[model samples]
Target: MKTWKVLWRVMMVLCVCVFTVNIVSYPQPEVTEVLSKYGSRSEEVRQIQTKLKQWGYYFGSVDGIYGTQTQDAVIKFQKKNGLRVDGIAGPETLAAIGISSSSGSSGSTGASTSDVNLLARTISAEARGEPYSGQVAVGAVILNRVEHPSFPDTIAGVIYQPGAFSCLNDGQFDQPVAESAYRAARDALNGVDPSGGAIYYYNPVTATNEWIRSRPIINTIGQHVFCM
Candidate 1:
């Protein structure tokens, strides 16, 4: 009987140890990992930081690192926008923050057909052979300039303003718009400004305009330098 009791106690201890080991081996999953998380670093995260700061949800620097502060800001934005509040910049969260994943109805400009066609043609002419983001950035610069006090308040006015775009004076702006240019125009209208609110962009290699070179640069994309 003494031997049996001792053996039973040992078996119980072994069972408890095995159970603890299993518990530790498999932990719970995180909230979500679609867009970004704590410790993530990328350009997308940097853009997210900038947008959140612009909208007053974040006060941290616009660094590409996604740390505790970025996560906190994301949570606040999600809460304010009635998202899942998982503290992750997923597709829904990003769209609500003025960044859309696909071409949807998030931040549409609601302009007429004439305006879109003109912008599309301008984008195709100015940003031809550039990356898709660069194309969108070009379109965004026009939109940004339209809102700036220093530039014309209308799309046509900005595009037609003397000495604003080389393509306009070089007859390139009259070229037929490409399919990609149309998509880029729609994206820009939907508030997808990859230039981060830049009002101008110029190619450093081919541009001879010294006056444009003197503007404060905001960011670079493909072969263009976006400026404020």
Candidate 2:
């Protein structure tokens, strides 16, 4: 009976270890966070791809590129939303289409409204005119500012400070935001960063600050140039 008891205890310990591993391996929402920050695949890209698949926008695979089928779907969404029918995902187009991002974010993290809104403003100013991948990168810029020693430690401070963003200075950021902008912000709030740890971005042709110009260039998309 002593030998039997030892075998049972060993089996219980093994079972406990297996259960712990399963818990660790379970696919958490945080998986999206990992993909958001480091991954090049964008949330908007995923959203458009999913929407196109659902709404019969495209019969092809949901690749993240804004090619023909995706463009057609965007036009369809724009037509549905009473926007100018441009087969492109511009700010107006993104604004017109209602996005249904899983509110799985704030509910999961209990994030405050201000945090969410601040992120949304940044998204609106930076990536509203750009593509979905660019939106995530803009959100990453705010998060990077929080961690950087030279800038303010919060999103509101970084955004609201004088001369930080043209939109913030001219009250453009205060305008009604697109649903895509809101979703992008929520994605950022939920820890999706796309800037690849970029600390600064500027329009290269007009950049005057010598210090700003000295940083290594990372990527250029739309009108902004991102840097470390």
Candidate 3:
């Protein structure tokens, strides 16, 4: 009887050890990092809404609230871009939308990183096939419009102004941005007026507006004629 008891105690100890080992070796579930999702409200959410609205993805107001509407919009954007359709604005989604997760303030030009990204996207959309100098010139024309009294004073305002850019309506603005366009945007913001101080530019071969053609020509770069 004493031997049996001792053997039983030993078996219990062995069972306990096996259980502890299993507990220690078991795989843990991955912890996902969520940047924005439903019930989240912040400046980042507002920026996301603004960008989606600009791209014609979200029709709701930019109230900074990540509700069902916001989630639906994010899902749509993800679907269009071939991203994971989780309806959560994770790092990848934020980066794809041209927004930085960092809270860094605007640059010396009083333009935030998003502004540079928007300008770069515009240059990419409008002058993707143009020469490097022409790309910079396109960015310069947009910046000039921002400074001109007749146009909006803000970059977003000027870019989104009704009928300002044809690319915005022709679906070209939604395409991927070119790498050169980023450099052109930065140069244009730095006051590199490759368009020769001209506030307007258009491709003569494709330009349909007689008024734009009638504008006094200032410089010619690549296929675009810069005008005032």
Best by TM-score: 3
Number of clashing pairs per prediction, in order: 0, 0, 0
List model 2 lDDT by residue over 49-108, tens digit each. Answer: 665565455666766666666777666755543456767554433322323333322446
Please say which candidate is ahead in lDDT: 1 or 3: 3
Using lDDT, rank the candidates from best to worst. 3, 1, 2
Q: lDDT winner between 1 and 2, please give it.
A: 1
In model 1, how many backbone clashes occur? Answer: 0
Those runs of model 1 whose alpha carbons end farther than 4 Å from true positions after fitting are 1-108
Off by over 4 Å in 3: 1-103
Estimated TM-score for each candidate: 0.52, 0.49, 0.59
Tens-digit lDDT track of model 1 for 144-212: 988899985667567656667778668786666689998999899889999999998899999888998
How large an RMSD does model 1 have? 15.3
Global CA lDDT of candidate 3, please? 0.84
> Quick one: best lDDT, which candidate?
3
